[model samples]
Target: MATEYAFDIASDLKTVQALELLSRHISGLTLTWNGKNRDYLVGSTINISVSEQLRSWQETILEGFGFTPTLSVGFRFHNNTDFDAFSEIMFQATMLLLEHAEDAVLLFNYEIIVLQRLGGKLVFNAGYQMWDDDWLKSRLSLPFERRPLPSPLL
Candidate 1:
Protein backbone atom coordinates (compact mmCIF):
# COMPACT_ATOMS: atom_id res chain seq x y z
CA MET A 1 0.00 0.00 0.00
CA ALA A 2 1.11 3.56 -0.71
CA THR A 3 0.47 6.62 1.43
CA GLU A 4 0.95 10.28 0.72
CA TYR A 5 1.80 13.28 2.90
CA ALA A 6 1.91 16.87 1.83
CA PHE A 7 3.09 20.16 3.30
CA ASP A 8 3.85 23.73 2.44
CA ILE A 9 6.80 25.99 3.16
CA ALA A 10 6.52 29.74 2.71
CA SER A 11 9.59 31.91 2.55
CA ASP A 12 10.27 35.60 3.12
CA LEU A 13 12.10 35.98 -0.17
CA LYS A 14 10.74 36.59 -3.65
CA THR A 15 10.03 33.76 -6.08
CA VAL A 16 13.29 34.22 -7.97
CA GLN A 17 15.38 34.53 -4.85
CA ALA A 18 13.83 31.47 -3.29
CA LEU A 19 14.48 29.49 -6.47
CA GLU A 20 18.06 30.66 -6.48
CA LEU A 21 18.54 29.63 -2.88
CA LEU A 22 17.03 26.23 -3.54
CA SER A 23 19.19 25.76 -6.64
CA ARG A 24 22.31 26.42 -4.63
CA HIS A 25 21.47 24.32 -1.59
CA ILE A 26 19.30 21.53 -2.98
CA SER A 27 20.98 18.73 -4.87
CA GLY A 28 19.46 17.45 -8.12
CA LEU A 29 17.07 20.36 -8.21
CA THR A 30 15.70 20.90 -11.69
CA LEU A 31 13.40 23.27 -13.50
CA THR A 32 10.74 21.58 -15.58
CA TRP A 33 8.46 23.26 -18.04
CA ASN A 34 4.87 23.15 -16.98
CA GLY A 35 3.27 21.36 -19.89
CA LYS A 36 -0.13 22.75 -19.14
CA ASN A 37 0.98 26.33 -19.13
CA ARG A 38 4.08 27.39 -20.96
CA ASP A 39 4.55 30.49 -18.86
CA TYR A 40 4.55 28.60 -15.59
CA LEU A 41 7.22 26.25 -14.17
CA VAL A 42 7.72 23.49 -11.66
CA GLY A 43 10.68 22.66 -9.44
CA SER A 44 11.67 19.22 -8.30
CA THR A 45 14.36 17.80 -6.03
CA ILE A 46 15.39 14.26 -6.87
CA ASN A 47 16.29 13.19 -3.36
CA ILE A 48 12.85 13.23 -1.78
CA SER A 49 10.62 13.08 -4.84
CA VAL A 50 9.20 16.43 -3.80
CA SER A 51 7.88 18.94 -6.28
CA GLU A 52 7.03 22.58 -5.60
CA GLN A 53 5.06 25.27 -7.31
CA LEU A 54 5.90 28.71 -6.05
CA ARG A 55 3.52 31.63 -6.36
CA SER A 56 3.05 35.15 -5.09
CA TRP A 57 0.45 37.86 -5.42
CA GLN A 58 0.32 39.38 -8.87
CA GLU A 59 0.60 42.91 -7.57
CA THR A 60 3.82 44.49 -8.76
CA ILE A 61 4.79 45.50 -5.27
CA LEU A 62 4.88 41.87 -4.18
CA GLU A 63 6.19 40.14 -7.31
CA GLY A 64 8.54 42.96 -8.19
CA PHE A 65 10.07 43.27 -4.74
CA GLY A 66 10.37 39.51 -4.28
CA PHE A 67 9.20 39.79 -0.69
CA THR A 68 6.61 37.05 -0.62
CA PRO A 69 7.34 33.47 -1.63
CA THR A 70 4.77 30.77 -1.04
CA LEU A 71 5.90 27.23 -1.78
CA SER A 72 3.69 24.18 -1.87
CA VAL A 73 5.38 20.75 -1.77
CA GLY A 74 4.24 17.15 -1.44
CA PHE A 75 5.63 13.63 -0.88
CA ARG A 76 4.15 10.27 -1.88
CA PHE A 77 5.59 7.09 -0.41
CA HIS A 78 4.51 3.51 -0.01
CA ASN A 79 3.59 2.71 3.58
CA ASN A 80 4.77 -0.88 3.28
CA THR A 81 7.95 -0.16 1.42
CA ASP A 82 9.32 3.35 0.90
CA PHE A 83 8.33 5.27 4.01
CA ASP A 84 11.74 5.52 5.66
CA ALA A 85 13.65 6.33 2.51
CA PHE A 86 11.21 8.94 1.27
CA SER A 87 10.70 10.38 4.73
CA GLU A 88 14.43 10.87 5.06
CA ILE A 89 14.45 12.61 1.71
CA MET A 90 11.69 14.91 2.91
CA PHE A 91 13.64 15.78 6.04
CA GLN A 92 16.78 16.66 4.18
CA ALA A 93 14.91 18.80 1.65
CA THR A 94 13.04 20.66 4.38
CA MET A 95 16.24 21.37 6.25
CA LEU A 96 17.88 22.81 3.16
CA LEU A 97 14.95 25.10 2.40
CA LEU A 98 14.62 26.44 5.92
CA GLU A 99 18.32 27.06 6.18
CA HIS A 100 18.17 29.49 3.26
CA ALA A 101 14.98 31.29 4.16
CA GLU A 102 14.49 34.21 6.51
CA ASP A 103 11.13 32.83 7.62
CA ALA A 104 9.22 29.68 6.71
CA VAL A 105 6.09 27.74 7.64
CA LEU A 106 5.53 23.98 7.38
CA LEU A 107 1.85 23.18 7.05
CA PHE A 108 0.51 19.68 7.46
CA ASN A 109 -1.37 19.10 4.24
CA TYR A 110 -3.49 16.00 4.69
CA GLU A 111 -4.49 13.26 7.07
CA ILE A 112 -1.75 10.67 6.91
CA ILE A 113 -3.58 7.67 5.49
CA VAL A 114 -2.30 4.15 6.03
CA LEU A 115 -3.37 1.70 3.42
CA GLN A 116 -3.44 -2.04 3.83
CA ARG A 117 -4.19 -4.81 1.40
CA LEU A 118 -7.31 -6.65 2.43
CA GLY A 119 -8.28 -9.46 0.10
CA GLY A 120 -6.68 -7.63 -2.81
CA LYS A 121 -8.53 -4.46 -1.92
CA LEU A 122 -6.93 -1.38 -0.38
CA VAL A 123 -8.30 0.10 2.81
CA PHE A 124 -7.54 3.54 4.12
CA ASN A 125 -7.00 4.38 7.77
CA ALA A 126 -6.13 7.63 9.42
CA GLY A 127 -2.47 7.50 10.36
CA TYR A 128 -1.73 10.95 11.67
CA GLN A 129 0.13 9.45 14.59
CA MET A 130 2.82 8.38 12.21
CA TRP A 131 3.66 12.04 11.76
CA ASP A 132 4.50 12.59 15.42
CA ASP A 133 7.68 10.60 15.06
CA ASP A 134 8.53 11.88 11.62
CA TRP A 135 12.25 12.53 11.20
CA LEU A 136 11.63 16.07 9.95
CA LYS A 137 10.47 17.04 13.43
CA SER A 138 13.62 15.60 14.93
CA ARG A 139 15.76 17.69 12.62
CA LEU A 140 14.23 21.01 13.57
CA SER A 141 14.78 22.27 17.09
CA LEU A 142 12.35 25.16 16.64
CA PRO A 143 8.67 24.65 17.23
CA PHE A 144 6.58 24.26 14.09
CA GLU A 145 2.84 24.47 13.56
CA ARG A 146 0.52 22.33 11.46
CA ARG A 147 -2.34 23.48 9.27
CA PRO A 148 -4.70 21.74 6.85
CA LEU A 149 -3.69 21.14 3.30
CA PRO A 150 -4.44 23.95 0.85
CA SER A 151 -6.77 21.60 -1.00
CA PRO A 152 -8.46 18.39 0.04
CA LEU A 153 -7.03 15.13 -1.21
CA LEU A 154 -8.83 13.19 -3.91
Candidate 2:
Protein backbone atom coordinates (compact mmCIF):
# COMPACT_ATOMS: atom_id res chain seq x y z
CA MET A 1 0.00 0.00 0.00
CA ALA A 2 1.10 3.56 -0.62
CA THR A 3 1.44 6.12 2.11
CA GLU A 4 -0.24 9.50 1.84
CA TYR A 5 1.43 12.81 2.56
CA ALA A 6 -0.16 16.22 2.46
CA PHE A 7 1.05 19.80 2.68
CA ASP A 8 -0.66 23.15 2.60
CA ILE A 9 0.73 26.50 1.51
CA ALA A 10 -0.82 29.85 2.38
CA SER A 11 -0.06 32.51 -0.20
CA ASP A 12 -0.94 36.07 -1.02
CA LEU A 13 -1.68 35.14 -4.60
CA LYS A 14 -5.20 34.31 -5.71
CA THR A 15 -6.31 30.82 -6.64
CA VAL A 16 -6.09 31.47 -10.38
CA GLN A 17 -2.62 32.92 -10.07
CA ALA A 18 -1.37 29.95 -8.12
CA LEU A 19 -2.84 27.57 -10.66
CA GLU A 20 -1.29 29.51 -13.49
CA LEU A 21 2.10 29.50 -11.83
CA LEU A 22 2.07 25.77 -11.34
CA SER A 23 0.67 25.09 -14.80
CA ARG A 24 3.45 27.15 -16.35
CA HIS A 25 6.27 25.67 -14.32
CA ILE A 26 5.29 22.03 -13.99
CA SER A 27 4.64 20.18 -17.20
CA GLY A 28 2.85 16.93 -17.96
CA LEU A 29 0.11 17.48 -15.41
CA THR A 30 -3.59 17.52 -16.27
CA LEU A 31 -5.68 20.27 -14.74
CA THR A 32 -9.31 19.84 -13.73
CA TRP A 33 -11.91 21.63 -11.70
CA ASN A 34 -15.00 20.78 -9.73
CA GLY A 35 -16.76 23.65 -8.03
CA LYS A 36 -14.14 25.48 -5.97
CA ASN A 37 -11.68 22.66 -6.16
CA ARG A 38 -8.99 23.06 -8.83
CA ASP A 39 -6.82 20.00 -9.07
CA TYR A 40 -3.69 19.31 -11.01
CA LEU A 41 -3.31 15.58 -11.47
CA VAL A 42 -0.21 13.56 -12.19
CA GLY A 43 -1.84 10.37 -13.34
CA SER A 44 -3.30 8.63 -10.29
CA THR A 45 -0.41 9.44 -8.00
CA ILE A 46 -0.29 13.13 -7.14
CA ASN A 47 -2.93 15.81 -6.83
CA ILE A 48 -2.44 19.52 -6.26
CA SER A 49 -5.39 21.73 -5.43
CA VAL A 50 -5.91 25.45 -5.16
CA SER A 51 -8.72 27.08 -3.23
CA GLU A 52 -9.78 30.65 -2.69
CA GLN A 53 -10.42 29.98 0.95
CA LEU A 54 -7.93 29.73 3.78
CA ARG A 55 -8.58 28.09 7.08
CA SER A 56 -9.60 30.59 9.71
CA TRP A 57 -6.62 29.77 11.89
CA GLN A 58 -4.24 30.10 8.98
CA GLU A 59 -5.69 33.47 8.08
CA THR A 60 -5.30 34.69 11.65
CA ILE A 61 -1.70 33.54 11.85
CA LEU A 62 -0.76 35.12 8.54
CA GLU A 63 -2.49 38.28 9.62
CA GLY A 64 -0.40 38.33 12.76
CA PHE A 65 2.66 38.25 10.54
CA GLY A 66 1.24 41.18 8.55
CA PHE A 67 0.46 39.06 5.54
CA THR A 68 -3.02 38.65 4.21
CA PRO A 69 -2.98 35.47 2.19
CA THR A 70 -5.57 35.38 -0.55
CA LEU A 71 -5.65 31.67 -1.11
CA SER A 72 -4.40 28.25 -0.09
CA VAL A 73 -2.62 25.64 -2.18
CA GLY A 74 -2.78 22.04 -1.08
CA PHE A 75 -0.49 19.29 -2.35
CA ARG A 76 -1.55 15.72 -1.77
CA PHE A 77 0.59 12.74 -2.58
CA HIS A 78 -2.00 10.04 -2.55
CA ASN A 79 -0.06 7.20 -4.09
CA ASN A 80 3.38 7.89 -2.74
CA THR A 81 5.18 4.58 -2.62
CA ASP A 82 8.72 5.97 -2.78
CA PHE A 83 9.84 8.47 -0.21
CA ASP A 84 12.69 9.89 -2.28
CA ALA A 85 10.52 10.68 -5.28
CA PHE A 86 7.83 12.22 -3.11
CA SER A 87 10.29 14.39 -1.23
CA GLU A 88 11.89 15.71 -4.40
CA ILE A 89 8.59 16.64 -6.03
CA MET A 90 7.25 18.29 -2.89
CA PHE A 91 10.42 20.27 -2.27
CA GLN A 92 10.69 21.48 -5.85
CA ALA A 93 7.06 22.55 -6.05
CA THR A 94 7.16 24.29 -2.67
CA MET A 95 10.28 26.22 -3.62
CA LEU A 96 8.84 27.29 -6.95
CA LEU A 97 5.66 28.57 -5.33
CA LEU A 98 7.53 30.41 -2.61
CA GLU A 99 9.68 32.22 -5.15
CA HIS A 100 6.72 33.93 -6.80
CA ALA A 101 4.39 34.35 -3.85
CA GLU A 102 4.38 37.71 -2.14
CA ASP A 103 4.18 35.93 1.17
CA ALA A 104 3.76 32.26 1.95
CA VAL A 105 3.81 29.64 4.67
CA LEU A 106 4.33 25.90 4.22
CA LEU A 107 2.60 23.52 6.60
CA PHE A 108 3.26 19.84 7.02
CA ASN A 109 1.96 17.57 9.75
CA TYR A 110 0.09 20.60 11.06
CA GLU A 111 3.37 22.39 11.83
CA ILE A 112 4.91 25.29 10.04
CA ILE A 113 7.94 24.28 8.02
CA VAL A 114 8.84 27.54 6.34
CA LEU A 115 7.36 31.03 6.32
CA GLN A 116 8.37 33.77 3.91
CA ARG A 117 7.34 37.39 4.10
CA LEU A 118 7.11 40.01 1.41
CA GLY A 119 10.47 41.42 2.43
CA GLY A 120 12.14 38.15 1.34
CA LYS A 121 12.78 36.94 4.86
CA LEU A 122 12.34 33.21 5.46
CA VAL A 123 11.91 31.53 8.82
CA PHE A 124 12.20 27.76 9.02
CA ASN A 125 11.00 25.75 11.97
CA ALA A 126 11.93 22.14 12.50
CA GLY A 127 11.02 21.15 16.04
CA TYR A 128 13.39 22.97 18.40
CA GLN A 129 15.91 23.72 15.67
CA MET A 130 15.81 26.46 13.08
CA TRP A 131 17.00 26.09 9.47
CA ASP A 132 18.13 28.49 6.78
CA ASP A 133 16.95 28.35 3.19
CA ASP A 134 20.15 26.87 1.82
CA TRP A 135 20.30 24.21 4.51
CA LEU A 136 16.72 23.20 3.95
CA LYS A 137 17.18 23.16 0.19
CA SER A 138 20.28 21.01 0.38
CA ARG A 139 18.62 18.54 2.70
CA LEU A 140 15.50 18.29 0.57
CA SER A 141 17.45 18.13 -2.68
CA LEU A 142 19.13 14.89 -1.71
CA PRO A 143 16.30 13.39 0.35
CA PHE A 144 18.08 10.23 1.53
CA GLU A 145 21.02 8.58 -0.15
CA ARG A 146 20.77 4.84 -0.43
CA ARG A 147 23.56 2.87 1.22
CA PRO A 148 24.32 -0.81 1.23
CA LEU A 149 23.67 -2.53 4.53
CA PRO A 150 26.56 -4.15 6.30
CA SER A 151 27.07 -7.82 5.50
CA PRO A 152 25.71 -10.30 8.02
CA LEU A 153 28.15 -12.12 10.27
CA LEU A 154 29.65 -15.10 8.41
- What TM-score goes with each of the models? 0.41, 0.62
Error (Å) of candidate 1 at residue 68 is: 10
Model 1 lDDT vs. the true structure?
A: 0.40
Best model number under TM-score = 2
**Can you write out model 1's per-residue Cα lDDT over 68-118, one digit (the tens) per residue?**
335544555534455555555555555666654443323233433222221
Candidate 2 lDDT, 103-124, residue by residue in tens: 6655553344433343565544
Candidate 1 shows a clash count of 1
Report the Cα lDDT for candidate 2. Answer: 0.54
Candidate 1: misplaced stretches above 4 Å?
A: 1-3, 35-69, 77-81, 100-154
Colliding pairs, model 1: 14-66
